[model samples]
Target chain A: MNLSRTKIGAILAAPTVVYMVIFFVVPSLILFSYSFWSSESYRVVPDFVFTNYLDSLHSAVFWKVTINAVRIGLTTAAISLVLAVPVGYYLVYVSRSQTMLYLILITWFSSYLVRIYAWRTLLGTNGVLNAVLLQLGIVDHPVDAFLFSSFAVTITLVHIYLPFCILLVTSSLSEIKPDLIDAARDLGTSSLGAFFRVIAPNAANGLAGAFMLTFILVAGDYVTPQMLGGSSGQTTGLLIADQFRKTGNWPLGAAQAFVMFVISIALYFILVSLGRATGLIVKRRTINPKGI
Target chain B: MLLRILVWAVLAFLISPLIVIVLFSFHSSPALSFPFAGFSLRWYAELFNNAQLGSAVMKSLTVAFLTSVVTLLIGTTASLAWLRLGKVGRGFIEAVSVTPIALPGLFVGVSLLVLFAQAGLQLSTLTIVISHVVIALPILIVAMKARLALFDPSLEEASRDLGASQFQTFRRVTLPLIAPTLISSAILAFAVSFDEFVVTSFVAGTETTLPMYIWSMMRRTVTPLINAISTLALLFSILILLGAWLISHVRRRSAVAARIES
Candidate 1:
């Protein structure tokens, strides 16, 4: 006997739906509500109040930390995109090898903490780079700023998240049929012209998605900043984490998280819309393939 | 030529840290500085002798294994159901499931911590597993959904038309078709769970996972022993990735061969 389609769908989907609601959505609601509650003397009061939100809004430290996070996030996203697009282009258009893609993914699968630790080892005052520099007499003393600064955090984040951007852009570039470029070239478009006129438009979605994903991950990253940022390496994630673990200020932490969440969502939509507009313009250009 | 150089440079940047960590793992001195005074296996031995780290590894393995199995089962079923539904219903389900990955891990960790506490459940290994499932599910679903998207509906329809039940059709026709995806996704889920630290930190209570172990050690002090453990972890990760790459490579080659024969 066969079940109706909807019945089968419902039956199959129920477990995941129920699981996510109990595990994901309910907890999110709990978090949301907690943002409206207040915390005093390390105890969360269950009454509704806007103090947490107000504190987050009014606190100069909150803005500074949030802006710092945004700065790192954007810097990481930009650097990763710049570094990765070439690799993505090389893989899809030049080498066309699955081996290269898989090699990058292998690095992607390697432990996240290990990667950060490696950076810590490399950039420390007595670390590898400093050792080399000192031996070369490039500096009179070790650069204390290299290890614990925002610069270190940005560099580490870019390294950690670059593989994802490459994957994203490579997937996007692959979706642009080689024939489309050939068609544009056949119509007397130069190679670079064909890239701008044909390829970049088609690849915009992946580029945007990559940027957004990396931005959110980098922005929300607590570990890297906490580990490498030293005194200056504070991010909103570390702050939110501090609330729960150190201060036991759950309401304030939850409020800050939602604020970060809103900022991420806004950035995501802006990138997406920009990508769509670019894609649309490219489609219009391609309509006149012979006119080139 | 220019692009090739750039690609290689990026690759170097990506892998340099891991190489450095592995190099420093055998240093005689505790300092992370270069120019290793001497090579020794003492740190490796210390890594093994640390009972807390040993237990944390075991606990992490257990949690990762359970996470893989649970997410694989649930994600596959949900993805299959996704194929049967309207676009709106499918989108809703996808959004609900995938959003967990997009949100900050701290938020997921703290929120889950609050929820569990509110329900009057004690935090333990069980709570860790539940949180891990939430983290691992989206990745598993993304992999399974990609595989399912490629699957032909005609095969399943034909099996049903020939008087097979849905389970029989799935077992005979669909399951074998997506087995590679299932395996790879399971590996991915396991890797994510194994390497996870943030959520585990929040919900772990008094327990430890390997990441938490590594973290506490790093926070307390850097040692050659930590480097030794990191090197081992890196090696394990490389082996898993190589296995995954090889499986997909072999599958692709066979698929190409089958196409030629047909």
Candidate 2:
């Protein structure tokens, strides 16, 4: 399988390289430029200002809603991780048939919008969930409280992101050697104990990747809250959206968007370093320190 | 176990709303309410009967299809090129292209609006497709990248050494190998563009995509027409997902066989 590295390289590297430079690099600065430009009532400024970033930090409402969005983001990440990790573990470690493996993946491909839209229909006052609840005498009347609550928003996001967590976690679990589990069990460790000590710690990188990806998605999402959260669904996404669409406050919106932009990057970097460090640590200590 | 109950309930929860939308679409009632007095297909009948709504759906499908095809072509070629970049350049290529997918869609929408305005471009179908291609390009890149990573670059050289030209080698060798990924990426891109209401609302002049149409309808009056509209429109996405799922299902099964063969 000898390959001419040069010829193979030239043929594969020409088109995308140019398109990436033009569309991605050049246009991204256009976005970054807007973040720096001053805007009065959505009108772009000829002059740049450092004040937008300052203002973003100082606004009480901005901070309040941002904190709310972060809370929701972390909560969504946490809930998804908790719910998916074990199931992903089960899918990779326990499932025997290829059919079951794809059943998990098929669950991932379920229409995303339809899944979100389902929440609206189910949670709405006259929706099916309420109808069922009322009929069952669980509640005497329809619950408007179900729809548009932050709880509803969080729950919906968890459902939406659960499949993502599963995909990452199960893949991570698959990377573990099957022999390691058998070795632990044969060496007088209980099956459950072996999983916790040997398998759980080994799959740390995947867990962190799942968490970071879900957190980033949740933090950036406005639709989930706007559609399901109602009047109270004020996250930074909602704020930035309003500033752009309704308020026509481009300066403020750009400022808020930049803040969120920075936060997600920061979170991603933290997770990246953590992943790298853990992977290195795992590699260096490839043998158990106990040499058991 | 508690986990099984919870997981199934979540799946049910995920699936039930869309089913309800379909059910409501068929409801004869003018307003959305449960325990309907009767059932009829007027809403769906009316859905097709309305020319404006019907055409908007058609326009959205056309726009999404165009976006998918163009993005796929661009992305597939780009992915091929990306494979040959040095490690540092490859890292840059990966980061720069995927950064759009990471950025908030709201930011990209507004930023593209500015870019379009700055270029003095009109908010025509072409502009809409251009912007969507930018947004959808990264996703296509990602799909193609996975396939590219799997591709043995020497295979192309093998074709070339066997006396085929560059284009011929690619046409016969590379394209077929990555065809599944290319097709799936196009479908996924279409799904993204089709469901995209927020970005479309910003950039789409007076023209409406299906999501934009649904958004306006949801606000003005929660009509039975909406359920009908969504029912007809969202089926495209469902069909896409199911088809992709089936393909991946087969691929996984085959992989197991390959593993055993080895």
Candidate 3:
């Protein structure tokens, strides 16, 4: 029985397509509509009003947390990528064994909340870091800034996410063959020059993708920031979570979430353009023979 | 030499937190500070006696099991379609599938919350399962697609040429070839759901998973029991991952032996 390709595709895909439409797509639309609606006395009223968005825009708390979220997000992503690149480079180009890659991935599966709690224990006032500091006579007193600060949030995020960034970087870098680097070297270029002139341009899109993905996840993270982030470490994620859990305002939470989403999308475009303008990402016109 | 050192240093940094959690779980005193006050099993003893923690673990296991089963069914069919679909259909499906992972978990969670509220559905273990399936689906689909991409279509064609029906060919031919990948992806889906917290936090109104239980404990006070529970969670995750690796390793060895014999 020969079936048409389209018919076969539809048959195979119908289950998930229908499931996503019901559970994912429809919910997102409903959430978007809720953003325009208003809530009164902990109840969402179905009406079109810009108060949710407008109120959020005018609110000082919104801007403060959003800025804080962005700062933590950018710092964590930058540190994660900077730390991941060397490992990714070594795994892809310098090493032949898969053992290191697997070991790194094992760290990723060690549970997320456990890692955050681990950081809290390590950085608390009576924590190991302070204990070690006192033992070394580096300071007469335990440093209060070690935990419950943005610094704690940022460092913990970097630790939790660095392995993920490495996986992304290695996947992207593996696509650029060693032959390309050898060719650049043969053309009177130094190793560093070959990397920047040959590799940086080719891997730019994937690198940018890795960076932006880490940023989005980190910025949107509510758990880590809340766990370690003291009063000053509050972020948009925590604030938005509050509207739902504590404040009982679903519409407002939905609106703030959409605002954060738009900001993330806007940052993606800006960063990509920045890369293009700086000539780090070169656009090539070569067509793939495989016609993917 | 410098690059190797840097890579090892990063790996150490990545692994340190887990090590600290495990070490402190055995500390004699409740203090999390160093200069170990000798070893003890008191926290582990507490872990075994805590009825709430025991129940939360059961709930997490049930949710993870259900989520992985549903994800496997949907993801397998979807990935097969992805391999068979035309360019436009494939692209649309791929984009829709991957969007969940790309966006923040909070977005998915809040959106689902609004959705359930509008639909007038009560939040329970059922809602948590639904949300987890959504979270785990993208991961399973992506992993399955990568495996399916390397499959040879001609074998299926040959099965069809020999008078096997499409379904028969899939069961007898396509299924066996991809069974290893299916098992691995299922394990991965289980791991993803088991460790999921952010989305679970939103949709879970009154239902408490292990992470939720842990969060409550952390908020209430600092204790070695938290460390003991966390250590157990870490060990469980590591065991699951190791199971996946071992299965793949055994499968590869058998395949090599079969090839040599034939």
lDDT per model vs. reference: 0.85, 0.73, 0.87
User: For model 2, how big is the CA root-mean-square deviation?
Assistant: 4.3
Candidate 1 has a TM-score of 0.93
Candidate 2 - CAPRI tier? Answer: acceptable
Residue by residue across A236-258, what tens digits does model 1's lDDT show? 99888988885569899999999
Per-residue alpha-carbon lDDT of candidate 2 for residues B1-262, written as tens digits (9 for 90 to 100): 6545665565555455667778888887765566765789888787777887777878888998998988788777666666566776677667767777655677777777667766788888886787788778887887777667777878886898899987798788777666677777788888777777657766888898777777776657657777776676666666876676666557656755876999
RMSD of 1: 2.6
lDDT by residue (A124-185, candidate 3, tens digit) is 99898898899999989999899989999999999888888998898899999899888889
TM-score of each: 0.93, 0.85, 0.96
Docking class of 3: medium
What is the C-alpha lDDT profile of model 3 across B22-134, one tens digit per residue? 99999999989888999999999988999999999999999999998898898778867876787888778877777898888898998898888778999999999999988
> How accurate locally is residue A152 in candidate 1, as Cα lDDT from 0 to 100?
93
Q: Per DockQ, what order, best first? A: 3, 1, 2
lDDT of 1 at A284: 30
Give the worst 10-residue stretch by lDDT in candidate 1 chain A: A278-287
What interface RMSD does candidate 1 have?
Answer: 1.4
Model 1 alpha-carbon miss at residue A48, Å:
2.6
How many clashing residue pairs are found in candidate 3?
A: 0
List per-candidate RMSD values in Å: 2.6, 4.3, 2.6
* DockQ category of candidate 1: medium
Best by TM-score: 3
Per-prediction DockQ scores?
Answer: 0.74, 0.40, 0.78
